[model samples]
Each structure stands twice: as C-alpha cells, then as structure tokens.
Target: MKTELVQCFVWGVPVYRQRFSLVASRPATERFYRLIRSAMAHAEQLRDPFTGDLECDETTFGGARKGKRGWGAAGKVIVFGIVKRNGVVKAQPIPAHDRASIMQVIQARSREGSLYYTDDWQAYATLKLRGDHVVIRKEKGRPVGRDHINGIEGFWSYAKNWLYPYRGVPRKHFHLYLGEICYRFNHRDRDIEPMLISLLKRLTVDDVDLN
Candidate 1:
C-alpha cells in the first residue's frame, strides 16, 4: 500500500481526497473505499443474535422529492433496523416494509423470546407469537409509558445524519453503505485506527480482491 493510501485511511476518505488528490489518484481513492466496503460486509456477518429488550423499526431513506413524504414516499429505500437496548444495531435495506420483510429480519437477528418494542405497524403484529411484542402507538407528543422505540429510532437518526453529507447514495450500492454504517455503529467505542488496521490485514490475507 502507498503512503497516500494510509493517509487516506487516517484522515478519512473525503478529507484525504480533497487535500491530497494530487498525491493519490482517483482509482486509489476508490479502491480504498471499496476495501472499507468489503471489510464492513464481512463484519456484518459476524453479528450475534439479540436476546434482550430489542427495538425494531423501519425508516425511509432519500432526499426531498416531489411527491409523497414519510412512509408513503416513492423512489426511496426502506430500511428495517433491530437494535438491542444499549447494545449493537443491525440494519438493512429491505425490498418492502411488509410483514414478510420485517419478520424475516426479526427472525434472523433476534432470539425467539426477546422482548420487542415497536410502533403500531401492522407488520410487527405477527411478532407477538414469536416474542414479547410491545406496541406503542404513534402520537402527537412524546410517549408517556415504558413503551417507546427510541433505541432503534436513534440509530436511524444517527445513520441518516452520517449519510446526509454524501448528498445521496446510489440505490444499488446502498446495502454496502448500510453495512458500513452498521459496522461503524457497532464498533463506536473502539479505537478506529487499530480496528481499521485489523480489517486491512484481513482484506490482504483473506484473498478477496476488492478491486
């Protein structure tokens, strides 16, 4: 790896690209991003199942558009997230926000008996059979009781804020970017330098060509 590539990792891709474009070519920058994407994809597979109080929710991602807004928006990506209270979060872009789609994520990421907190979405109604499902109806003001989906809702805000600076992400590659966000959130407390170095080592030894 070139010194500029290491600098790219240290300073972050956007900063390195703006300041050192003359030092590293565009292809090298893209390669580094691809490497990060590949490492994130790998880390996503190692998630442990959620077993405690979990929050589940779905949110739409996209910029301001001409037509519908919020859940009814068109041309936007729907993402479902399951977050263990005060723990890790797992999120993915789903094809739809239907029962089958949301249930698939819950079944895969959460344990059978874990307590689930969600809004009054029809899709999550089936979760009652599989777990202790708690529904909090959406209201004008803040929630009053112990029933709130704030954990997963916070993750959605965090992800959207982090992604906002990029303007917009391409739909086809959104999954990879989503994986990266989840990886970052999962490892939020760790020292990024060592974690990134370890990922780079795995990238090299795993014989996976990210190019």
Candidate 2:
C-alpha cells in the first residue's frame, strides 16, 4: 500500500481521487494526500538554507473571483518568499505583510553576511541589519546593470504557473501547497522523483499511519 500510494502521487498519471477513488473512499484518498504532504513538508524543511545572494519578495495568491487585485484584495493569500540567485527558494503564506511577519521568514531561512535584493517594501527594511540589503525600486522601470529582484519575481511566476492545475487550493491546505511549490522549485533542475519516493517510504513503512 505504501509503495502503491507513493507511485500514485509521483506519477500524477491519475490525480488525487482519480483511480484511487475507484478502490478507496474519498476520505481515504484525502487522508493519503495529507500524509504525503506531511512527508514532503518535513523533507523540504530539513534542507540547508541559503547563505548566498538572496532575493526577497511577496505576492498574493488565489484571487480568481471578481474583486480588487493584489494586496488587500478579497480571498487572497499573501505569500512571502526568498530565493537564492542560483536556485533554491523558500516560501509560505504569511499572516500579514507587516515587518513582524516577513522578518520571521527571513531570520529562519537566511544567514548573516549574505548579499541580497528586494523591492522597495518597508517590511524588508531591516534585512540590512543581518545582511547586505539591496533595494530595487519597481517604479523606476527596469533595473540597471545587475540590480534586480528578478529571482524572487521569477519564483512567483513559476509558483503561480505550477499551481494552475490545482484550480483552487483550500485555505486549510494552503501551507502544504506552498511548501510543495518551494520543494518543486528548489529541485527543479534535478529529478525529484527518487527524493520524493524516499521521503514517502521513510514516513511510512508498511502503510500510511494517518491516525
């Protein structure tokens, strides 16, 4: 059951509750999804954080309905993210865009002495206290020379495009989806199939203990 479940998840040949639904109930499939999500989240968190050039940024997710867009729009989830210039990114749906909230992610995932970039948001003002902070003013058109927060911005675009298939993610499961996105982005260059399978197997020996 464990191997079968892991294969089903990695293949995506049949999405959640697709072929699994034929044999198991909806609740069973849901439980399996939750279990795998936990494994994925734990695996991603254990990775060594970035200590090199970093790009910080924020973006809102899930604004499909009609209403205002960006920041303060209804039914939107504000996500704070930091991406290393070369690759690996870490992101999560934050409570608010305030300094207190955004700083938590920065402090947890980044190390001091690293040079970085960000948009002209006041919340990231204190990043310089720990590392070299380079501010990129978005209103001033394209960045000159190598000045840009393009890495984080590119991550946002990649995350949104990857999430399109899910249609809409539930608020309760938003963190898992965001974590999955970060994991995918970090491992985008390599084949993540074996890593994902290894994580799943470690989390479950015989079958998922979803209790």
Return the top candidate by lDDT. 1
- TM-score, per-candidate, Cα-based: 0.88, 0.84
Per-residue CA lDDT of model 2 for 56-85, tens digit only, reads 888899846787766878889999988888
lDDT of each: 0.78, 0.76
For model 2, the run of ten residues with the poorest summed lDDT? 13-22
Model 1 lDDT at residue 118: 86
**Candidate 2 residue-pair clash tally:** 0
Badly placed stretches (over 4 Å) of model 2 are 1-5, 12-23, 139-141, 204-211
Write candidate 1's Cα lDDT for 1-211 as tens digits.
4455655554445533355454556666666676776677678867777898999989999898998787779889999999988989999888886989988888888899899898887878888898798888766857767678888888999998878766787677778778878887888887566676677677754734353
Instruction: Specify the highest-TM-score model's number.
Output: 1
- Candidate 2: how large is its RMSD? 3.3
Per-prediction backbone clash count: 0, 0
lDDT of 1 at 170: 65
Alpha-carbon RMSD, each predicted model: 2.6, 3.3
